[model samples]
Target: MADGLARVREQIAAASARVGRTPEDVRLIAACKTFDADTVREAIGCEQMVFGENYVQEAKVKWPDLKDEYPHTELHLIGPLQTNKAREAVALFDAIHSLDRHSLAKALSRQCENQERHPVMFVQVNTGEERQKSGVLPGEADDFIAACRNLYGLNVAGLMCIPPAGQPPEQHFDLLAKIAARNGLSELSMGMSSDYATAVAYGATNVRVGSAIFGNRFYPPAGQ
Candidate 1:
């Protein structure tokens, strides 16, 4: 874990340098999906304070006690979020990167109002329009982002995307950067264990990296 964390830090610096951006310009979220609390503690030992999780249930099982123990840590929900779990998600996450639809926006708004927990959000964009993915298609991204901000009253921090696998991610990253530019958003939550360097080169402000930092997730849902 220490070696993996070191490598990612080095890579992040190198990637940022390639684009003439400082490493401080990019925030690293240690995607800890399927990783145990002990591993997370190990990451904290390595000075990783931000983390991303795929499931609310799993975060619930892990973060409550962990957060109490490590009060400075921040958690981001980087996977599909169910509308029914909005309140639970509100209570658990410090940030959410899956605001892809109007229904979710509505549910989250109501929950934020009720709970007064305004977790910063990113409207996930499906740059490749993959049916199996959970993000707004590129064409609808603008309208969805507008509604999420103007109507639903959610805090639209930026955009997020999972570019097509085995394909060059530069175009998709560019699309996301353009969308963020149009929306006047400063954050771009893209990239992962693979291709994050390209993501950084394309101006990603927050990169969600899991396997590269935490080693491989041995259970279901595998990587983040």
Candidate 2:
């Protein structure tokens, strides 16, 4: 884990230098989906403080104890979030990277009010316009972002996106950066293990890297 993370940090520094940005300008979110506490702890021992998890239930299982042990670490929800689980998500996540719809916004707004644990929110934009993806379509992003801030009162701090597979991601990254620029948002949570360097060139403030840092993941049986 130490060697892998060190390699990724080196890449991040190189990428940032190419664009005249320092390594401190980009935050690395160690995507820790499917990895267990031991693997994640190995990362923490390497001083990797920020992490991203996909499932709320899975995070619930792993993070509470981990957070107890390392109170300074921050956790982010980087996958689609269910409205029914908004309360728990608000309490557990330090940031949420999947605020795409109005109903989910309403649920999160209420939870933030009830719990007073307002997590930093990121509006996911479907830059590739993929039907199966869970993001606000690019055309509707401006209005949606406005409503999240004005109507729902959520702290919409940044934007996130996942370009369509097998396509050039630079255009999508550029689009996300433009949207963020016009909206006055500074954070852009795009890129992954594959294209983080390119994303840094496009002004990504955060990159979610998993496989490149943690290596290939092993999942349990389909129906455990």
Candidate 3:
């Protein structure tokens, strides 16, 4: 685990430097979704304090205790968010990288009102316009972001995206960067383990990585 983290960090630095950008420009969010608290503790020992989780329930079980032990550690939600989970998400994550809809923006706003904290938000965009994905279509992102800002009054930070499988990811990254700039947004959550180096070369403020850091996710045998 230690070696894995050190390697990833070094690679991130190299990737950033390839484009004359400092490694400090890109924030690595170790995607530790199915891993246990012990896995995260190992990462913390490695001084990798930021992580991304896919499920709200899974994160709830692990992060609070980990945060209590390492208060500086930060967690992000990198999965599709249901409006119903807004409050729980607001309480658990420091930032959310999947704010994809007006309905969710409204839900998060209400939750923010009650909690008095607004988690940083990244409007997820389905750059390829894939039918099966969770993000807003590229055509609608501008209006959606505007609504998230003016109507919901949520802290709309930037944009996030997942390029279609087997496609060149550079264009997707470029498109997201342009959209973010047009909105005067600063953050870009647009990469995963496979293409994080490419993402850094572009303009990704955050990368959600998992397998490269912790190896493959192991699941129980069927019917366990």
- Best-matching candidate per TM-score: 2
Stretches > 4 Å off in candidate 1: 220-224
Candidate lDDT values, in order: 0.93, 0.96, 0.92
* Per-prediction TM-score: 0.96, 0.99, 0.97
The residue ranges of model 3 lying beyond 4 angstroms of the native Cα positions read none
Per-model clash counts, in order, read 0, 0, 0
Poorest 10 consecutive residues of model 2 by lDDT? 215-224
- Candidate 2: pairs in clash: none
Q: What order do you get sorting by lDDT, best first?
A: 2, 1, 3
Residue 47 C-alpha lDDT in model 2: 95
* Candidate order, TM-score descending: 2, 3, 1
TM-score attained by model 2: 0.99
Return the number of clashes found in candidate 3: 0
For model 3, residues 75-193, the per-residue Cα lDDT tens digits are 89999999999989999999999998888899999999999998999999999998899999989999999999999999988899999999999999999999999999999998898
Q: In model 2, which regions exceed 4 Å deviation?
A: none
Writing each residue's lDDT as its tens digit, candidate 1 over 1-224 gives 88998898899999999879999999999999988999899999989999999999999999999999999999999999999999999999999999988889999999999998899999999999999999999999889988988899999899999998888999999999998999899999999999888899999999999988877778656464
Candidate 3, TM-score vs. the true structure? 0.97
